[model samples]
Structures are given as structure tokens and as C-alpha cells.
Target: MASNNTASALEKEQIFGLAEKEMEYRVELFNKLTHTCFNKCIEKKYKESELNMSENSCIDRCVSKYWQVTNLVGQLLGTNRPPV
Candidate 1:
């Protein structure tokens, strides 16, 4: 019983570690995406504090393309599982 408990504890620890790693990776990806898309889509720096129509449309396309590529790569790699 003690050995079983130890094994379960180890498994839980491993799962938690993996979850943490995934969260970290997702955060990194989000940051990169934000930087890349903002640079690519926002051509003009406006002082109005809100995105213009063109900027909003560009950002929409940028995010859509990003996810499309990510999903395509995931499918090609046979790891087509949806993110948690």
C-alpha cells in the first residue's frame, strides 16, 4: 500500500510538472505572437489609443493565420490533439 501510494504520488508530480511546462510554453508562444503580430499588422503608430479599422482587420488576419499554421503543423506531425 505504501509503495502504491508512492507511485501515485510520483505520477501526480510528473503530471503537475508537465502541466507547468505546458503553461510556460503557451505563455512564451503568446508573447511571441503578440510581438510578431503587432509589428506586422500595426504599421502606423496612432496616438488615439485604439486600433483603427485597418489595424483591426490586419490583426484578425494575423491571428487567424497563426492558428491555421499551428494547426496544420500539428496535423502534419500526427499530434493533432487540441490544446487543453
Candidate 2:
């Protein structure tokens, strides 16, 4: 029916809007985490230091682990669920 189609279309739009908002929020969080983690994992005084292999490796692993933690926490908070 035309009314059913209209309702479905509206629902899809609402879902899409929510998804967009969630994506924006995730991008913001990622940017913040990258900035904070970079400060914590790297030394300002060693800016001129060529990529110390060990430091680079540590930073890479820390970022990966932090991302995993963020995802787990986000899942626990039901971030993927629709708002009431």
C-alpha cells in the first residue's frame, strides 16, 4: 500500500540519520583518542629522534589495544542500539 511504503521510507530515513550521527561521533572519538594516545606514547623532547623501532612498535600496539578497548566499551554501552 502507498501508506505502508511511505512509513517504511520514513523509517529508513530515520535509521540512516541515526547511523550518520553515530559515524560522526565515532570519528570524533577516534581523533581525540589518537591525539591523547600520541601525547602519552611519544615524547615531545624526542621529536627529532628517527623512528626508534621499539617505540614505533609500542605505539602501534598501544593504539591497537586502545581501539579494541574502545570498541568493547562501546559495545557494552549498547552504542549500536537505537535510542528510545
Candidate 3:
């Protein structure tokens, strides 16, 4: 029926909107994580063109902790549902 079709289309639109929002949220999360971790782990004094071993280890720990906190917060907020 036309009404059913309309309802389905509306649902599809809503799903698409949610997906878009999710993508935006993920991008923002990534940007913030990048900035925060880089600032926290990487030294301002650029002694080398590439990361040294200590910097690399610091970055690894920073990223792991960031994800852990993110996941914990997501779980607390009940928004950590497996993606559809």
C-alpha cells in the first residue's frame, strides 16, 4: 500500500541519517584521538624526522588507552551496540 511504502521510505531515510551521523561521529572521534595522542606522546622537540622507539611506544600506549576509554564510555552510555 502507499502508506506502507511511505513508512518504509521514511524508515530508510532515518537509517541513512543515522548512518551519516555515525560516520561523522567516528571522524570526529578519530580526529580528536589523533590530536590528543600526538600531543601527549610526541615531543615538541623534533630531534628526528621519524619517530624514535620511545615515541613509538608512547604512541602505542596512548592509542590503546584512548580506545579503552572510548569503549568504556560507549558502553556506559549504552551506545556501544554492534554495528548493523
In candidate 3, what are the lDDT values of residues 1-84, reduced to their tens digit?
Answer: 999999999999999999999898888888888999899988988999999999999999998988888888778778863222
Return the TM-score for each candidate structure. 0.85, 0.64, 0.83
Off by over 4 Å in 3: 81-84
What TM-score, to 2 decimals, does candidate 2 have?
0.64
TM-score of 3: 0.83
Instruction: Give me the runs in candidate 1 sitting further than 4 Å from their true place.
Output: 81-84
1-84: candidate 2 lDDT, tens digit per residue: 999999999999999999998898777877877786688677777766486776688789878877787777768888863221
Model 2 steric clash pairs? none
- Per-model CA lDDT versus the true structure: 0.82, 0.77, 0.86
Clashes of 1: 0
In lDDT terms, how accurate is model 1?
A: 0.82
Most lDDT-accurate candidate: 3
Write down the worst ten-residue block by lDDT for model 3: 75-84
Candidate 1 clashing pairs, residues 3+ apart or interchain: none
- Go through the candidates in order and give the clash count of each: 0, 0, 0
